[model samples]
Target: MENRIQLSFTVDKSLLLREAISQYGISKKALTSIKFEGGQIIVNGEEKTVRHILEKGDIVTIVFPKEKKSEGLIAEEMCFPILFEDEHLLVISKKSGMSTIPSREHPNGTLANGIAGYLEKNSSVSTVHIVTRLDKDTSGIVCIAKHRHAHHLMSEMQKAGSIFRTYEAIVHGSVEQDSFLIDAPIGRKDTSIIERRIDPEGKQAKTSVEVIKRFTVNGENLTHVRLKLFTGRTHQIRVHMMSVGHPLIGDDLYGGSLAIMPRQALHAKQLKLVHPFTKQALTIEDEYPMDIAAVLEKATIDK
Candidate 1:
């Protein structure tokens, strides 16, 4: 269960070991790690340098360096459902009110700590390489990489816009449009350290929103909406929804009423991506959180 990858390759034609490695999209940084770190490159059962020439049909193997756990992360036992798992990746369901990683304010009882405990129990890699993270108050699926190589590949995929995430939210008011795009820029608020605002000088942000249902609770209008983020900005959905006068329910920071739901009524519902190593399509979805569903069940559908 060591966080090491042993990749085997067959040389179809004559070439240097370095060139063959390049064909597999191995970066120069990985090569450097191999050379300096405790990794190795072997040819036909013998260790060899990258410059070594390889004959046709020769077997090549690359043993990636063993990974180490991040400092200051302590293992803690916490129950979480594993949505999907493999040798390289793990998809976990995160409940609301849990921080993704340990911080100064909350150093333990985090999702990372829980995962570390899980890995320790299994004697797997101790490092918790979270590929996707959610806010402390948000509930949903998070993808974790088992090794650094997998993390690197997932990072590249994210940059290429191949990693897609979908969210579900209950907003304050009934949306006028059934489907539309929220095209705006988001920037840090001038006064607050943790707040964000829609600013013209901010980075571009886009969110596609589609209404799923409209209902009334206690004579208050509400809309359940499905949202897709085209950009990863801090507090983006909260800020964008506020800008359009439809702040999410229970999102007090964004001027949402906390009368119905306690914490921002938002959930990271789904994720879509292609497995970096297996090159297979993956679509993972989390069921609607019970807290949100409970609120919706008390409402009457809007006519």
Candidate 2:
């Protein structure tokens, strides 16, 4: 419920809090939020402001107050895997087959439903607010805010590029290049209500991809790719990969053959962001599931 993080540094040279924060790679946004949030910056057992100068061997401790959870959401009893959880945010490790929130058909059995069940016991959280979403078949990290203020803060951070999201996938073919950028416009498909594709008039979308590994399986070529999302869009990864002629292995809707897995072979692997209230830099990673791990195992090294 309560968390404390201390970033201790030995001053090789004298410095102020600003210089030390820069040297230590601390979040400046976090330092500024101390006025609003219930946190303290302690230096050598004494509380001090950021303007205080530091000498050698100063131990700094940051105290993060436990956040107040809200109420009103009806909780569902599903045991969704939690990657990281605190008062401010909950990072969920979503399964490949689960939806983040409810649709007309999937009104229940969703991540939101599970979160509601979780908050029911805590008695502090109000409505469920999902900060990030994953496609039903794409498994990985999804962030949820405990309250509305946290939601607004995270959304602004995402627009400013402070909140970073990354994913990994097994695509249909070997990539000729080790790394490349897919800078394309994405728009909704005319035929499908949920499907998206490359369109000249659509909003700008960019995905930076790096090949982690490449191999052949049953004479079929596949590449393991890590992609960084610059802009979040519906079916961005699935659509972009298809445009490049290498859709995800099991993404049938996006020109991919469904032979290995039943769902798209994409994982939300990493998420990085600054804390909305505490100002800490946060990183969450989901463990590779056995389904994807099995694919990695069968892949023969492609030289």
Candidate 3:
């Protein structure tokens, strides 16, 4: 059953309706959308406009419209490792090789397709609102907002840098420094449309890597790396790591050796964000996937 939403607030001081709405962190776009859907903001049982002034003891109420699920998205009954779910959002542990969204190459069998099936099974009435995304070969936590309001709030948090994400990877060589920052600007490679490279006149990109532990595979040193991204660029982590002479294991696109692993060993291990409606903080995490773990086990030497 969909939860009934009726936000009520009592005026403690005199203020314009628009002022109160802004102070309450309500989106102006939401307000316009509500109006289009016949929902209204009422003050003391009377419908009011944003210009309306409020007095002390005035009761204000906001009504939300019905949730509408997305249409035309292929709903495939595929399995996913769901970590946390609520009425507002879902946290899923995506597996490697599964694309996050649908595209021409991946029209079906995507995370979105699986999620569409789940929503249909539960009889939900909302569209898929992907708050964060990962590359097709990367596996880890993905946040899907169940409604537009939650999506908007979470996006605001991301822009503010309040939604923090951390990744774990197995890089080719043992890093020389314990921790370092890759403050290089990234842009589309001149030769390829999909590839990215560091350029002097590119978008600013920053990534910080920490050396967690060092191990070796058949006498060759490999680094267990933890990464924090300050910017979201196309193939940022992969490109940045490659620029440092330590491309992720199994990632051959950027000159990584794929002798043992088939796919990139990068994993989205941690996600921290505040709940949109509840205002509660949530930190979601998942262990390394089987494929990555299998490659890690190939390490014959540990240092």
- TM-score each candidate: 0.94, 0.76, 0.91
Lowest lDDT sum, 10 consecutive residues, model 2, at 1-10
lDDT of 1 by residue, 1-303 (tens): 154677888899999889999887678898899889889999999999988999999999889887777888999887899999988899999999999999888899999999999988888853889999888898999999987778888888888899999999999988999999999999999999999999999999999999999988888989999999998899889999999999999899999988998999999999999898788999999997898988878875433
- The runs of at least 3 residues in candidate 1 whose Cα sits more than 4 Å from the true structure, single-residue gaps closed, are 1-3, 300-303
Q: 1-303 in candidate 3: lDDT tens per residue? A: 145345677889999988887766679888887788756789999898888999999998877676666656888898888899987889999999989999876689889999888887877776688988999999999999887777887888888888889999999988999999999999989999889999989999989999988888877789989999898888999999999999998899997888768888899999988786677899999988998877676663344
The candidate that achieves the highest TM-score relative to the unseen native structure: 1
Off by over 4 Å in 3: 1-12, 42-47, 55-61, 300-303
lDDT of 3 at 206: 89
Which run of 10 residues does model 3 get worst, by summed lDDT?
1-10
Sort the predicted structures by lDDT, highest score first: 1, 3, 2
Clash totals, every prediction? 0, 11, 1
Q: Model 2 over residues 159-271: C-alpha lDDT tens digits?
A: 88888999999999889899999999999989989899999999999999999998888888889999999999899999999999999999999988889887899999999
TM-score for candidate 3, please give it: 0.91
> Which 10 consecutive residues of model 1 have the lowest summed lDDT?
294-303
Candidate No. with top lDDT: 1
